[model samples]
Target chain A: MMGLRLILEQVSHAYRDLSVLDGITLTAAPGEVLVLVGPSGCGKSTLLGIMGGMLAATGGTVSVTGEVAADCLNPLTYVFQDFALLPWRSVAGNIDLVLRARLPKAERQARIAEVLALTNLTEFAGAWPRQLSGGMRQRVGIARALAVRPACLLMDEPLSALDAQTRDLLLDEFAAIIARAGTTTVYVTHNLKEAVRLGHQIVVLSRRPGRIRATVRIDRALTDRTARDPDLLVIGEELWRMIRDDAAAAERERVDAPA
Target chain B: MPRLEGPVHFRAAGFAPKDRAWASAATLLGLLAMWQASASFGLIKSLFLPPPVAIATALWHLTVSGELWKHLSASLMRLFVGWTLGTVFGVGMGLAVGLWSALRSPGMAIVAALFPIPKIALVPLFIIWFGIGEGSKIATLAFGVFFPTVIATAGGVDNVARGLIRMGQSFGLSTGAIVRGIILPGALPAILSGFRVTTSIAIVLLVAAEMIGAERGIGAFVLSAGNLYDTDNLLAGIVVLSVLGLIVAWIIGRLERALLSWR
Candidate 1:
């Protein structure tokens, strides 16, 4: 799939009087997976939203590279933390939700089937979200996004809602499916292991009123993401150190503040 | 590897109707027994409290003579037409107010201002406008049903998750598509529940409207029976009204089951 590269420049934002993000810049290369890791309230999600064009950065420009086809269903799509599957819709129906406008009836069915197979959700296509476990529901959420054939995917803690075991089990599947889809993605998470597992470029930000702390590039192939490489762990640890101090400071500040 | 587990369903079995029937039947039988004993022992005057047997016999004659059906049919027809009208317009207007920002406040203001006023108090106004025929009765029921439905429907729409709507917009879905795919179904549980309230309101309004200047409704029969002091027929009319309410509630229960199987 043709992917889009995103570029952010000196982005800063605030909610009325409360500041959230400071001047910061980053580039997500085409077909690259960029993960944003930071403490809670670091504005990683705000940055992701800006990149997805869902939020307008107050002071800077977020742009994309490469020509977008006029017929693209969505150049940017999001997979939410809550799965956000329409409970009334079946798995296949949920996937078809995004494809209904992009393709005709027969072609839409084919696309849903293809996404279901990719996400390993083919067997439960008729199942309602209420009938699926948390992990499978999130898979359906991913499948719905994939059916849009988005050039860029923006995810906000997609697996954080799952239990640790489910997150661990689905990590490999996610890496493989996303690898196959080949969409440029900016994933926001606080989990360092997940950041290292999926991101080709890990961009770390500091606490509230977040600013860039560090950026690390991993040269490992997507296939290698399936196994826990020592180098990846080292990079994960380095990334952790970058934010640990800021996270502790943020926590202390929260505690010391008036309730 | 993924766990390969079957889909986990949130299926819960509701109480069987058969299990519920016996308890209700017992309570009814015990009440009937007490009334029969009171009447037979003359603890209360027959004119004041006719036994269940007398009421049942009156109901039997009304049924055989088809007098009960005439009033029942008229009342049911008004309830059906009025509630259906109210629900249709209520859902449509609710969606309008819910989706379009321009209409939200004015519509809500109109609803809030009008909803609390006693609907029965407007039957005289409705009669003047729509006439003393079935139109006024239906209009009264419709008016009573409309306000609560609008509140419930708009509330349901407002409660639909903003995240899902944003997701739809991100997927390039048009407004209409988002409403159909996300909004309406999301609001359905609330909308269906609103019907429960609206139907009961409609029945009350129907009876009230029928009591005034009408000759063929259960309300009229009850009023006339009361004037003549035919306590048995008066009680029979009350019993018919109770049965009508039960039937309406039962129909609504069935509708909820059919429409909300997804939940």
Candidate 2:
């Protein structure tokens, strides 16, 4: 499955008196991993939501430039921060849910099996979500998104919930999964190491009333780097230096503001 | 004498039932023994408190003559018809109120106003409306069961996590698909719990409705037996009601296990 090109042109969004995003223009090319990184109050998530059509920008155009393939199961899908899996559904059941409406019975079964294998959730196919570890549950979440053969996948801090060790382990697994799926993705996170490691193109946003700060391009192939790859770790540091001022300002604002 | 002490004395799995049947039987037998002693010793008047044996004897006689079946069949029939009607309509109205924005406010307002008023008191009004027959008796039970079911169903739907619904939308699931796949199963645990409460309410209202005017129900038999001073039959009828409640609870327990196995 190929990806869809998502374009945002001079987009602005506001919630009453508060402006969240402003004059932002970016393009996520087909099959590219565009990582959005910023401080806590930045509109990285809000932008991802707009791209996925979960939210609308208050001003300007957010458009998909490519036609969705007629055979594609879903044109776009969001992977939520909390995983958002139905607890009642087993891992296979969760993956099958997206395909149930459109696919033939045989195709649905095949797609569920394929995604389970791809996400390393084949062993957990019949296990309920409650029975899985946190990282495994998120694998089901990713598998569910991929079962659709979506053109674009939007993810919002999908690993923010795991402990440090799990997060470290799962980061490599996630990179491999996304690399194999080849779906255009807009990933949002505050973790700089994650940004530089997975991002083909990194778009940094400033704190509240978020606008583009810097756009960094990573030339390294995902297969060439492990989590401890020196070049990848250097880019992670570079990403931190770019956003450290905004993050520090946001922190001080939190300390100064009334509860 | 040696006493078991420390962790070895207690069962390793605290929740595991250990000789539960024996414990239950011993407690019941002890209670029956105490009751018989009181009656034989004349601590309480036999007229006021019939011994367990007298009650058991009356139950045996009623069962042999089919008198127990006569009262029991009528009450069960009413319960089946009334509870079925109430549950069907209650679930329908509940889904409508939960899913449709237009029905939500007005339907909730009507339910809130009607829910708290004693449904047993409405039996006299129902009798006047539907006559002193099975119609009035059934209406009382249906009315009593409907409100709570609606409240439970709507609350359950409300409590389904927002993220799951959003996930459904993200997957491009239709509204009907989302309701059937996500919302209904998500709400089942709460709705089944509501059934436990509604079944109890249904039984109580059934008894109250039967007491007022019904001729062939346990409630009516107990009231008439009291009037005739047949304490044995009266106690026998009360025991039947207790067993009916226990059966209803057991059915709900089985249903919860079957439907909510994931929980």
Candidate 3:
């Protein structure tokens, strides 16, 4: 299946007087992962929202091109940072939530089973989200997103809520899933290691009114990258160096500001 | 090797008070026994307290003569019809107020204005409007329950996570589907607990409405018995009301368990 390509043409946004995103132009190519990395308050999430059409840009336009599969229920789906699984729904029930509206009962069950199995959650289909650990809950989130066979997946810091060990484990699993599905994905996070490990194209944004400060391209396949690779580790450090001053400035500003 | 000394003073122990069913039963039984002993020893006159035994005897005679059933069925019917009407309308209005921005301010303003007025004080006014019969009685209970139910339901809707609703929309679920699948279930815990409050309010208004007008309800029976200086039957009616409250609370508890087992 050919994934849809999302093109942002000089998109910008502001919350009333405060401009959050400024002249952000980017493209998430078909069947590639475009990772947006930035410091806090840098509108990476806002950009993702604009790309997914969940939020309209106050300026410029976001256009979608290319074909999506006929069975795709949602062409642009989100994997939320908080892992927004309904506490009342079982793991399978949560995945079924998205599919039940479009698919027949038999097809819905099969799709749920496929995604659950893809996320290594086959044994947890009956478990409530509260009963699962943070990592497992996120697995349900990913499974739910995949159940729709989304043409373009928009993930917003999906691993930030998990612990270091679980994040590492799920990061590897995410790389594998993205590789296998080959769906155009726009991932937003502050973690350079994740950007290096999963991104085909990494775009770094400036602080506050987030602009595209730098764009780094990595041509290596997602599943082939590793945590300890020298070249990728250097890329991670380089990305950090690009954002270090903004990160430190944003941090101290946050400390001084009233909550 | 130095070890952690003296069990670290066991500082984390206390403050976790647990409910003991046996202790609860024992306390009630002990209180009743003391009251019975006081009555038997003539420490208190039966004219005032009527003791546990006298109350039970009166209850037995009332049940045998089917007078308790008459009063009970009447009160139960009023409670059922009035509370049901109030709840159905209350939930509908609450959802509209909570979901729609246009309705939120005006609905809340109206609710805030009406909710504070004492429902019992409105009984005579209701009697003039709905007439001096079951009409007035049910109206009193329904009016009493409606405000609190609306408040609880709207609060429940407010507490449903915005993230969940956004997730539903992102997945392209229809508006009706989102309300049914996410908003309704998310708000249910608050709504069910609200039932606990509204049910008790219904009972209180039921008693007040009956006392002011009706001839057959437990409240009316208790009021007449008190006027006649019959302490035994008066206490019997009080026990029946208390038991009814306990039963309703128990049913609500069972419902919470069944519906919210996920929590």
Candidate 4:
């Protein structure tokens, strides 16, 4: 199968009269990691939701692998920030949910086994979400998305819920895992450091109605570095400045608006 | 046994065995003593309320003569049949109405209107339609149980978290799979409680129906004893009914615990 490419052309989305995304255009090639960063309610997540086919655009086209309609991507999976694992299901059951449609019993078992090992979750297969720590649960979410073997993966602030150390550790693992899988990914977060660390191509958005403000390309070899690199810091600071200005402006707008 | 140490052991320890056993025994004795005192002191007339010992003696006599078994078996059969039918139809309809908007609006509106009409009020109609036999009795009991089960199950299914449904859809699950896998399990706790409520209603309706028109069963036995002023027999029959209801409820509670062990 051909690896996935996402192409969004002048895509606009609105909640009734309140427009969120306006005339936004972007693309992510096969095996590319596109990071979307903006202030809260700046339509970064709305754009991500549109890409994942969870929401439809009010205007323009979102083509996944040349499929014009979002629904055509039948197995487009997501890794949500909350790590929305069903509390009632065991770790293995959650992983199996994605593969239940296409794969037979044996193939499903095999795929689950492979992804469980990949995410280093083999020991906790039978454990419920409540029993596991937050980081471990997020790993289960990652394993669930990978188990689908999808053409593309969309993450909506997956690591934002974690503590600083856990977030950093998982970020490293996330970079390594996605690199090995080579699946096209669009990760949404407001954290500039995260955007700089994992994003091969970062798309910064203006405040609501959000539009792409800048797209920066990072060196792929940066993933090999153990420490926080100076290059990443420079890029993070630059992106932070852009995001801070927009966030302040958005806050001002919210305060000034009539209730 | 070696003495355990630390807060870990404290946490690991189950309920104190001595305290729990003693507490349970004391509770049972207290209830029995209260019943005996009430009946003996005539706070509750012995004709209306037999003491625990007198009820036990009456039970023993009835069991030895095999009379209690005959009445108990008949009542149990009616309860099982009516409850099973009511629960199955109620859950099925509830799931249908909860999942589908078209069905929910009209179907639930009708159920809500009719549910509170007093199922026993339909006894004369049921007798005319199904005749004054087991059919009429079972129908009354089943109808009584059905309404609550349907309402509860529908509410339960409706209350399932939307996040879980969205998650299931995103994974590309078919509608059937989503219902079977996510919706059903999500609603299991509420559905089980609905079943419990229906079970109680079925027992209540069964007794009412049996008392009105039936040759056998606990309620009929109670009615017959009342006419002869066989107060011991009447009180004994009521005791047996209470025990049967408790057993049924206990069994349902166990089933609920087993089924929802994952939760």
The residue ranges of model 3 lying beyond 4 angstroms of the native Cα positions read B1-8
Ranking by TM-score: 3, 1, 2, 4
Q: On residues A95-125, what C-alpha lDDT tens digit does candidate 1 reach at each position?
A: 8888876689998888888888888889999
- Better structure of 3 and 4 per lDDT: 3
lDDT string, candidate 4, A1-259, tens digits: 4578999999999999999999999999877899999887889888888887778899989887732223222446889888888877899998787667677889888877888899899989999999998899999999998887777889999998999999988988998898887778899997888888888899999899998898999866535754388888888899988889889988899889999
Docking class of 4: acceptable
List chain A TM-scores, every candidate, in order: 0.95, 0.95, 0.98, 0.93
lDDT of 1 by residue, B123-143 (tens): 899999999999999988888
Worst 10 residues of 3 chain B by lDDT: B2-11
What is the per-residue lDDT of model 3 for residues B1-263, given as tens digits with 9 covering 90 to 100?
88675554657888899999999999999999999999999999999899999999999999999999999999999999999999998998889998999999999999999999999999999999999989999999989888888998999999999999999999999999999999999999999999999999999999889999799999999999999999999999999999999999999999999999999
**What digit string (tens of lDDT, one per residue) describes model 3 on residues A1-259?**
4779899989899999989999988898999899999889989999988888789899989999998998898999999999999999999999988987688999999999899999999999999999899999998999999999999999999999999999999999999998999999999998899999999999999998999999999999987899889999999999999999999998987899998
Q: Candidate 3 at B66: error in angstroms? A: 0.8
Rank order by DockQ, top first?
Answer: 3, 2, 1, 4
The DockQ-based CAPRI class assigned to model 2 is: medium
Interface RMSD of each: 0.9, 0.8, 0.5, 1.7
What ranges in model 4 sit over 4 Å off? A66-74, A225-227, A252-259, B1-28, B37-45
lDDT of 4 by residue, B20-95 (tens): 7888899999999998998888899877777888878988999999999899899989998988888888888999
TM-score of chain B of 1: 0.89
Model 1 segments beyond 4 Å from truth? A68-71, A257-259, B1-21
lDDT for A218 in candidate 2 is: 89
